[model samples]
Target: MEKLNVNPNRMELAELKSKLAVAKQGHELLKGKQDELVHRFVDMVRESKDLRARLTEQFSDLYQQFALVGAELSPDFLEEAFLSSGNSANITGSEASIMGVRVPQFDFLLPKDEISYPYSFSYTNSELDASLRKCHRMMQDIIHLAELEKSCELLANEIEKIRRRVNALEFMTIPQLQESIRYIQMRLDENERGNLVRLIKVKNKIKK
Candidate 1:
């Protein structure tokens, strides 16, 4: 309940009143914004949790598939086979605005449209082929996971910022303004009473 340092005059009182009005309005707007941001943050957190679970399952499966394929082939041959495929995952991403937070949008460039395997069927074993297909499938989920992770990060940061601002207005700024207004009113009233007392004394003297 800290009051601002201010004079006890009508001009200062009017100025304080105006400030209090604006402060209250700003506090209301910030409270609304804080609620909205919290809602968004909670929603994103749930999404991220789901994505993480799915990604964990997928990655575990993918790793097991890779390990099985690795045991079936020599290291040199495995490297050669992977190199012969010449297929790569190209990623592109952009910024998407969600509640003023810039989240990421991701897409993958897979060779599957023109040629999925991009490798010779004669030399590669069935294990290699199967593992490669699984890898390709996993890349899509990996990209989606990336998008979710980034969105979660941005939302969390934005939520923190909004929360801080809301706290400042609700607890500090508005209270200080109201306190200053009350102090100014008390001072003005006291001054008015002193003037009235002076006028009464003058009247009494004139009568005497």
Candidate 2:
């Protein structure tokens, strides 16, 4: 705790008291912000966990389905089918504010033209086609899940920063200010008592 080097006078004491009040108020405001950040971070963490689990399960199934289809089809033919079958999405990116942090938001623009599967029927079976379509549809979910994970990463960083600030004010700044105030008051009281004793001695000498 660093003590301010200043004369222990009434004027300096008043100034220090005012500074202390301002520090306390700022500390309260920071604490409130920290609480809100923590709340948002907790929600994001849960969402991220759920999304990751879903993606893992769905992707595993997709891989297995593709593998089964591969056993029946030639490698060259399967590669050609996959290369031709991928669908394109219309994605628009935007920014959204959560608390004070800005996170990314995406909108998928629906195409006016009818959506069709990319693979030819001659080369692909029904289950193969179905898996391909399912994977295409999940593109949006995959993008959204990516967005959520990135948001969580950003929120985690901000949370750490706010935590440090709150800790500094709570454990260090407020206490130091209070201690300085107490020390000044103690010195002022001692000075007043010394003055009083000297005045009394001078009066006694004058009377004699």
Candidate 3:
């Protein structure tokens, strides 16, 4: 640890002590922030994992359903039906703050009449109708999963940044400040002893 360049005097010692106190206080604050950020990050990661798993399962089932429906209908007819369907949504994006980190939020607004199949129901079987309905209903969950994954990414980045800052304060700044304070105190004490000895010698000479 390197000592700061300052005069060996009471004024310098006092200043160093004050600086050390501030440094320690800042270190504690940063450590606290790092811990809290880590906790939240872990929780978000778990949540994202679970959500991803559920979505994956649901998507697998939805894919099989679509495949079955495809087998029953002609490719051109299925394509035409999907193209004519009037399923649409408006997605709105916004921001949310978690422990000073801003993450994204998304919401989808459905039309007043809700999603409707404009395709000819007479030509489509029950399987096709069911698959289309499920696909449209899954849109909200897909958006929610996207939001969670994005938030997790953003939170992870923020936690890494805080960890670096906390490590710097704990391992470098605080230790350096403490070392400088100690060096100044020792110098001041030695100087005080020298001055006292000099005064005693002058008194003895006058007495003689």
Candidate 4:
């Protein structure tokens, strides 16, 4: 026969019940947060798509300009122009937690007035210079959007996972535990009653 290790002290049952309540509360709170995150993530994805389209158009325009400047300017001239523009960009990442999920935060730094390349190059094409500036700005925007989209994805995934775990504990594990506890309590009561009847019978026999 398989031995049943039923907890008679009731301590384990109380502790598990407490944990079940906490798990249920956490599940509800996380579910709400998950819904919010889904909304936010959808918005970010839509924005990302629009931004990517716009960036593609801008890049096509830049390439056409590059081709127009062709034989007259070496590829080095484009590179040198970029360097001479005296603008630099730095991207940094940090972490933040939302509903027990760690998400990434990005910081962008752009420095201005680092180079006097326009006057030095003796290139009178202001339009090309303007296009370069537009490209630089677009690049920074793309980086920021990419980071936001990725973070949104990660947070959404984590929220879904936590929600599932909560559901399993609430709907399955806790109920099963409580059912087992009830069965054990009934069996113990039945055993006590049987012992009491046996003791009474023995007392009557001894009196006879």
Candidate 5:
């Protein structure tokens, strides 16, 4: 702790005390915010982990099913079927506030006939149908995972910033202010004692 560069007087002492009070209050508030942010960050990390695991499993299954379908079907037919698909997807972007951090939100939109297969069932194998259906169904999950990952990144950055500020107040600014206050108080007390001694000397001289 270092004393601030201020005159050792009552006025400086009062100012330092006031600053110390404000600093402490700020530290508490920042600490609370940091705790809340960390709690939310941990929850998001778990959610992101679970979501990624699920997506990885689903993707593996989808790839196997698609491989089987490709092996049995002609490339030209597969390309035509996929090209004829009327399904289209869109994402809408928005913002959400969490603990003063603005994170992104996404809405994955699909057509009403998204589940409708463009290719005739008589021409396509059942595996192909299943693969296509699963692909369309998992689109929303993919978007959700992206949103969660991005939110986690943003929250992590915010939490780091708040942590630094809290540390500064707790370890540096508050201690310096307190030390300055103590120094000024000691000086004032010593000055008061000296004044009292001088008054006693004056009274004795007058009495003689």
Candidate 6:
């Protein structure tokens, strides 16, 4: 708790009173913002959970398809096939600010060439090619969802920090300041009453 120095003059007391009012108002606004951020963070967590479940199911299906293709196709061969298909990705990242916190923005660019997967091997049939294509598409979606989940986590952490600060000001600092202001006011009033009594005594002496 912080204590304000008691001023002899009423001018300083008036200024302190005004400052106390402003601090109270700021505390209320910050508390409201904190509540809103918490609500938004909860929603993001729910969304991230759902996205993760979907991504897991899609990935499992893709792995089963790969297994059916047989071990004859080397991992390197599959990678090369995917690469040779002219499927290249461009990932652009930017920064977005929320309540003075910077969160990441992810942009995915898939050119027309990236959409087609071509196979060079004679054993590769249309079913295999179609499965590979679907897997590639799912991979892109997974990347996008991962970025979204990460951004949400980062934002939630920042919002929590802000909430703590707001709570400190609202529940602790502002109340302490108001208490100090009241103490100062009471002390000043006492001093004024004493001075008035002394002045009256001196005036009576002069009259005698």
Report the lDDT of model 4 for residue 79: 69
lDDT comparing candidate 6 with the true structure: 0.73
Models 1 onward score TM values of: 0.87, 0.89, 0.93, 0.66, 0.96, 0.80
Could you give me the TM-score of model 4 versus the true structure?
Answer: 0.66
Against the reference, the lDDT scores of all candidates come to: 0.79, 0.81, 0.83, 0.69, 0.91, 0.73
Clashing pairs in 3: none
In candidate 6, list every pair of residues with a backbone clash.
Answer: none
The sequence of per-residue lDDT tens digits that candidate 1 reaches over residues 6-49 is 88788998987888788788878867776887787788778878
> Per-residue CA lDDT of candidate 2, range 94-173, in tens?
98988788888887765633456666777678778768667766777788887888888888888788888878878887
TM-score of model 5 (CA atoms): 0.96
Regions of model 2 farther than 4 Å from truth: 112-115, 206-208
Better of 2 and 4 by lDDT: 2
Q: Model 5 over residues 1-208: C-alpha lDDT tens digits?
A: 7788999988778888889999999999999999999999999999999999999999999999999999999999999988876677789999999989999999988768548888888888999989988998888889999999999999999999998999999999998998888888889999999999999999999999
Determine which window of 10 residues in candidate 3 has minimal summed lDDT: 111-120
Q: Pick the candidate with the highest lDDT.
A: 5
Question: What is the number of backbone collisions in each predicted candidate, taken in the order shown?
Answer: 0, 0, 0, 0, 0, 0
Off by more than 4 A, model 1: 86-89, 203-208
Worst 10 residues of 4 by lDDT: 112-121
Off by more than 4 A, model 5:
none
TM-score of 3: 0.93
Residues 52-101, candidate 6: write the lDDT tens digits. Answer: 89889877887777777656566776776766654767888888765565
Ten contiguous residues with the weakest lDDT in model 5: 109-118
Candidate 4 clashes between residue pairs 3 or more apart in a chain or in different chains: none
Question: For model 3, how many clashes?
Answer: 0
The number of clashing residue pairs in model 6 is 0
